[model samples]
Target: MPIEQGSSGNNNVGIGNSNPNAMLTVGGGAPLFLNQGASSTTPFLAVLNSAYPTDARYGWAFYDNSTNGNLDIFRRNGTSQGIQFMSFNRNTGDVAIGESSPLFLNHGSSNSTPFLAVLNSVNPTDAKYGWAFYDNSTNGNLDIFRRNGTSQGIKLMSFNRNTGDVAIGESTPLYLNHGASNSTPFLAVLNSVNPTDAKYGWAFYDNPINGNLDIFRRNGTSQGIQLMSFDRNSGDVSIGTSNSNGNKLAVRGTIGCEEIVVKSASTWNWPDYVFSKDYKLKSLQEVKEYVEENHHLPEIPSAQEIEKKGFMLAEMNMNLLKKIEELTLYMIDQEKKTEQLKSIILKQNEIILNQSKRLEKLENKL
Candidate 1:
């Protein structure tokens, strides 16, 4: 009987073991059996550090909480009992991390670090390939990272807690506030080759300073070159140009559109009002005098004014219509005068014919 228990198992026992410290220690790559007949539901196994925790929290433990019937596999983390990091509810058959009461499968709730990580193949070549998601307690942000994907180091997406901002490829996004002030960006995507180079990226944000929605893209290292912008204050739009010049739309380049619609005022505002009886249709003489003095038609903008302020297309159309209506009225007056002159010419012809007949009768009497 080489197996011996020293006086009712009071002293330490060893099987192929050299340490005399452990009460029951198994060595030589063999399994250590605690008990063969104990209830499996009874939690008893624990692996701990050298010093015992006076608080009775095991450093490495497999135990049932007894309160919620949850079996927890715990490991030490920064001097705290991290049981919920890997816990399974015996009652609900739920596996969770950092969740006190898990209801579904693999439900994880965490604040500072990621609850789960799915790394690339366990091979050595995949060292820098992985994805992680976590809620950052420091900035109250939710961030997702791809180890080495888009442009450079590992920032895929981030959501800010305070500003409702979503940023991709940029950590600290800069935006413009309603008053054209520089606020943090709402959503940005930048993949430029260098930090100082804005040559290859684009951003969408609300400019705090300009109070407009701006779409900015980098082209050959240019910064803040807006591809398009919509003014929040004036409802103006600009393309290839940042300044709308108070116009509804301003384009720095040529535009080719299938159709463009510019709405005018109501029907009553059309130039048909010029034909109304109450309308003062200036005489042709008056118009001639005005054109001679001003070198332009009356009630029409001058060429200098058009060049300076730019004319409205719809307004100009209405003004041209008014001039055409005035011309038509002048033609009507001229036609009436021509009819009167024709009547006078016919009566003169009748008088000449009658006088010639009287002379003929006198000659017959002679």
Candidate 2:
């Protein structure tokens, strides 16, 4: 090594002349290795400005070998202000861009705007793409916005942490009025495409007509075909239809099943009125006359009426039970009449036997 001593007590080592201000300088460096002590905790390079002697820190880039060999770069704001801007954690494989205490892969930290913004170019002409996470001021929710260009962007999604509701797409989501029960319900996807073309998709809507949470399948543009529905108030489930016409469940296609078991309390009012004291027991003649005149039983709907208004199963069952109870009463009345006639014949037979005995006695005396 060739050495040159300067007037300012500076030492220059190697082939060329050194700058006068530098304390120690190396000339003609193919590669210069400034190796600190072999301690894993110490930094490999520390560039400090000697002008600020009291606040001695400046900037440093180091490889930490103690843990998982992480590379950390730090910058100084002022004489005493040192801030770490970038870190690569080898253990977790996470790179902190503008943050020192990073929790995620690309974390950002600042006092003004703490977010990560990826830019294509510093100039406005190039396309910029980035995503920002922030708190929404209006509703006090967590919002994530995605930017396409520099100026124009849209809010990608938001989450209300308090209510556990998430919203996607445009800021103002579609308001599906689910009455007063559910306040903050989330909608997964709402796609509005061309109306004329047949687009196959499904949607859950609060139907105003039937007052149900209806699941509808969109086949074309002419509204949506109701696939299923649930009565939020009554807890009734309707399949293949909304059951707007008084059916608990309705299916458009034939059902194939191994077994279907129905367990329910019947709502039909049984015909116990026949056993009541106020029940009017009509004569058989009167019942026959009424049936002949009307061509149907009294208080029962005729065939024409059934065809016109359709049949109510519960009402039809109750009517049939009433007829059965009336028939039972008629049978009991006939049984009582037959018992009376048999008693009269027994008395007639006893009288005839006594008259024969008297005739036999008169003949013996003669």
Candidate 3:
């Protein structure tokens, strides 16, 4: 190959070309290459070997992509192969590690030819920092971790791109807001299969029209079924339904519980106060009149009110107790009246007996 030097004073070199604009130019449909011999432990194009002795030990080396089609970026460790910082498959344009094809290629689960990894066979246990994405060949799961001056790498999340499922590790997502700024704040995740698949997935989003946060499950491309809803206006929550109209919590179906405690009972005035000395007891006639007029007990909520506003658990319990205590008082008063009537009847019977005895003595005298 005849080499020609540039006419300019810069002394630019050109191969197979008359003119050269750069330091060196090679033309004539040929490639510039370094044939460092087969299995040679040497740097083909070394740069400042004495200055960067450590980096130069396993750096600036290239291989012909013929045998396994792996082009390793670095050659580290005392071994000739060295730790592969990154490797690329020239034919498929896929990234891999350990000079081997990714396990996902044979498993046929991941996205098409999506493989990017970092592997160190020598120090396999040592964690790599600064944006190291690893895909476990054995587990067949992709993991992302971050090590910011910490002893252990925090596995941020694991994701299966094909399934579009992401599992969070120890770290959790947080929202920070101190004052009312009228900022519409929310977090949502959506996952779905291909459009043709009948079995669908789930989604969480805000319903602007209804003022609710909705979590729904989709099935067979139909309108999603709401699994849970949180009312933004009233702070009410509903399960198996969209709107919790009146109550703080509403369930479309029955709720089964082993034990239920009315935790807010302290806010209610218990009905034991009905027995206080200052309390006035209504007569039975007055109660009868009130019942006839209102068709419900006094101090008790009507059916309409309960239907619209929803009954308070603690307050209703206390009201029922008050009615029970009132009934007890009525019973006690009736028992006293019956006792007086019985005494009067007994006295009358004794007087009649004395009168009969006196009449008998008078007849004997006659």
The best candidate in terms of TM-score: 3
lDDT of each: 0.57, 0.54, 0.54
How do the predictions measure up, each by TM-score? 0.48, 0.40, 0.52
Which candidate has the highest lDDT of all?
1
Off by over 4 Å in 1: 1-116, 120-130, 133-155, 158-186, 193-196, 204-214, 229-256, 259-268, 334-366
Task: For model 2, give the 10-residue run with minimal summed lDDT.
Answer: 177-186
- Give the poorly placed runs of model 2, Cα more than 4 Å off: 1-202, 206-213, 217-225, 229-271, 311-317, 344-366
lDDT of 3: 0.54
Off by over 4 Å in 3: 1-96, 100-112, 115-201, 219-221, 245-247, 263-268, 304-310, 355-366
Model 2, position 247, has a per-residue lDDT of 60
**lDDT score, candidate 3, position 26:** 53
Colliding residue pairs in candidate 2: none
Residue 267, model 1: Cα distance from true site in angstroms: 11
lDDT of 1 by residue, 75-143 (tens): 544244544445576864545444332212323424423433333422111334455565667777776
Distance from true position, residue 345, model 2, in Å? 5.1
Return the candidate ranking by TM-score, descending: 3, 1, 2
Q: Give the distance in Å from residue 235's predicted Cα in candidate 2 to where it truly belongs.
A: 10
